[model samples]
Target: MSEERDTAPSGAAAPPGAAPEIALPERVDVFDTTLRDGSQFEGISLSVDDKLRIAEQLDYLGVAWIEGGFPQANPKDAEFFRRAAAGELKLDTSRLVAFGSTRKPGGVTDSDATLTTLLDAGTETLCIVGKGSAWQVRKTLNTTLDEGRAMTSDSVRYLKAAGRRVFFDVEHCFDGYKEDPDFTLSVIEAAALAGADCVVLCDTKGGSLPHEVQAITAEIAHRFDGLQLGIHTQDDTGCAVANAVAAVLSGATQVQGTINGYGERTGNADLITVIPNLTLKLGVGTLPEGRLERLGPVSRHVAELVNLPLDPAAPYVGTSAFAHKGGLHTSALRRAGTAAYEHVDPALVGNHSRVLVSDLGGRTGMSMKAEELGVDLDAGEAATLNDTLKGLEADGWVFEAADASLELLMASAAGWEQPYFRTEAYRVSGYHRADPNQPGQGAHLSTEATVKVWVGDERIAAVGEGNGPVNALDAALRTALGRHYPHLERIHLTDFKVRVLDGGAATGAVTRVLIDSTDGDETWTTIGVSPNVIEASWMALVDSLVFGLKRFEG
Candidate 1:
């Protein structure tokens, strides 16, 4: 195991008579189980390619272990390891770990199919999830507690004998500890005596509170003075991150979690949140120097690969992690920087501070947002625009989530004009066609759009088709503009969101649309609002094009 005695920063000496400092370990291993545990989430389904991509990202983030997948469970996972062994996927800083259960009760360790599959998976590290709860032993496994302990021992011993480093995950450990402390300790003792490199306490039920986790982990740490301890927690009670941190404080040297908290039920402890908390808040170390800033990109990249929408409110790497909206908060931020409203410097995690404009914000927020977008506006103009924004928001226009649209509004007030083209007219239609091959077949629906715009006295017309009205409109608009400005080719609509202004009005209510666009290098958001969904989408789409042209084409 790697070890370094923590010391004060260079050139700083301890004061005379100061108490001897408790030495902190320089590194805490981060074991990411996103591919194994995270894929168990109801909506999550990662292809082999997706899993490989995420594993690479985790390595880039400098996690200590990438729990690739369960090799014995599925063909996809088995194929992933096969490819990994064939050198299709390579990791620089992280060790690939193969996860599987311990040998079956009353089974021979060498003959266990799952154990053999794990060895064949070609990972230097092996993680065995053994039965830890005595109740589970009798009730679920239908076996005696001694057999459970023997399963744990034989598996660890056999794997260790094969020259593979083994980590024993004591599944349902916290509950087992609560019910029978001696039995739980005996299970851990079995793994340790069998030469396991690490023993991870798994809060499988995810119901343990932080205090309970700390006390149990403390006792385990005290009892096993020389064994490396790890923690794995689920978030059913919304305390996974807290419990993981508590376990670390009580002497855990490794953390096991999924990125973005992706897992079954409520998810596991989010390593994205755990990394910063361990290193920045608790003054311990994980990952490597200067890799913390990749947290945002890594989190978002995994979400993108898994086809999961990134949660904007996720802690640390979330979009709103460092955003300020209220006028009071903006005012304080403008005067005192982010420290006035945010707990940490956002840039520390590759995220930037964002000042949002909304009904809750006044002129101060407008000025702050305008300054951020590099729009030149006097105080009087800012105040006027702030009032204008409030009136628009009252009319169901939301600017907080659509910074690009807000910028366009402010710039238009400051005498900016659309340089590319002026929208003359546009129309969208949806139709259905019967399948010709099958009798009485259901109609296949499709959307088409026609757009016309005038650029320097020349009118451009285009038609496009897509799976949806908004997509068809976007395609038509881009077709019209792409001929005149080739730069339009770089802009792609990444995300579109729609929300009804008032649920009481139901179908007749106005809708608010937020469109996110990116030009390969940068992303911006625009908003539109109207009673008509098509009109709302059109407004946001046009604003997105204009913003992209202004920012990137210029």
Candidate 2:
């Protein structure tokens, strides 16, 4: 291989030993593997519908390419491609790419099932992974080195000849390069010779460091001049993002990653973190201009679509990424701006600064937080509120996760009253009945609730039945208020979480209930705590209703 020097683009940070900047191309493709690789995460199971929805989200986020799924893997994946082929799944800026492995051992190119599935996926682009390490090809696949090379070369040649843009993923390239330096380079040479449009060197095991990635990438970039190069790294060593950056610095033109770093094992490199670093920090162009700001919301949207909770500490997108809970940090942040305690402006990624109310918050922090929460507060009142909040925290009230509750508390302290409806009383009962005929169905549980509320002096009582006590209460409350506050129909409880504050008390423990409600346009979380779980749940339920009515009606 030639010893050509490779460096970063002009004004971009140079690699460790590059003499001249390796000028970046006009645009680097941001390929998203969220739908395919993201499903590899434990507890993540996506139906065919989920795959299509995730692809649409990735395209909306301005990804250049979306690896839909492995078409040959299962019926769901194949159906996804079938729907995509029929133009059922629409995309804006992203081209859907089909992912698969190269031709099987001793399989004819014309008759290979995997290759046929790739062609039938109806995607203009296809990404096929092939064993790159000589040891993997020889031992894992039980094939000779020449046959392994032929598998990759033939697959690429066949796909390219069919007019499909083929990108070959050299799986375990770093490990291969370490074991047999010459054979690894030969694998890439075979792909380029076979007319592969782009060659992606994949750190499949994700064990390569930044220095090792840069050194090997420098060599590959120098040797492969005709083909566009890319980097696909995993996160086992926690260097996936760093390795990806190193690869780009060494002249790679494309980056492949999953949103929120969702993939197998430790997961893939996080495109949410990588795009900002590449475009904002490295000055390399990716996505559309100004798309970086939508990253935070996009990350959250993906998590929600997959039914996975967002990691609040996730870089750039997490709720706590720009949240300040300390008095000193909040005070300095307000005085010196976000740069005081943050590396980048939170708004740059569509995230905003948050000052959490806690024992650590001082009067200044409380005043600033009050302003954010739309609660008018003078310095004296802020001091009082700060002291009151500390006292509440000490009493087991967590205001951080209950913003609606905190807002209501602040409004009440500021003499603002929300007298939508007055609840007089409520009663609930549960009964368990055994099924005599259907023994396999177990016991049948039933609940009934009765609620009475006064609206402008007119008291009304309503009875409702449901599967559980909380559900029955919600139904009864809604029934009682349906005629008076018809807008309550629009509000529904989306999530309900319960936590026992005193576990030692066991059956008699004090419990906290957090109720999340949404009224089409917005959502709010309200909390309540009490020794009786029913009482706690009712408090939160009523608060959620009041918060929704106040926002939507008033």
Top lDDT model: 1
lDDT of 1: 0.90
Residue 464 lDDT, candidate 1, scale 0-100: 89
Clashing pairs in 1: none
Question: Residues 276-360, candidate 1, lDDT per residue (tens digit)?
Answer: 9888876899988889999999999999988888899999888999888888887777666666766666777988888888889
When summed lDDT is taken over every stretch of 10 residues in candidate 2, the lowest stretch is: 1-10
Error of 2 at 360 (Å): 1.6
Q: What is the C-alpha lDDT of each candidate?
A: 0.90, 0.88
- The lowest-lDDT stretch of 10 consecutive residues in candidate 1 is 1-10
Q: RMSD, each candidate, Å? A: 5.2, 6.0
* Reference-based TM-score of each model: 0.91, 0.91
| Total backbone collisions for each predicted model | 0, 2
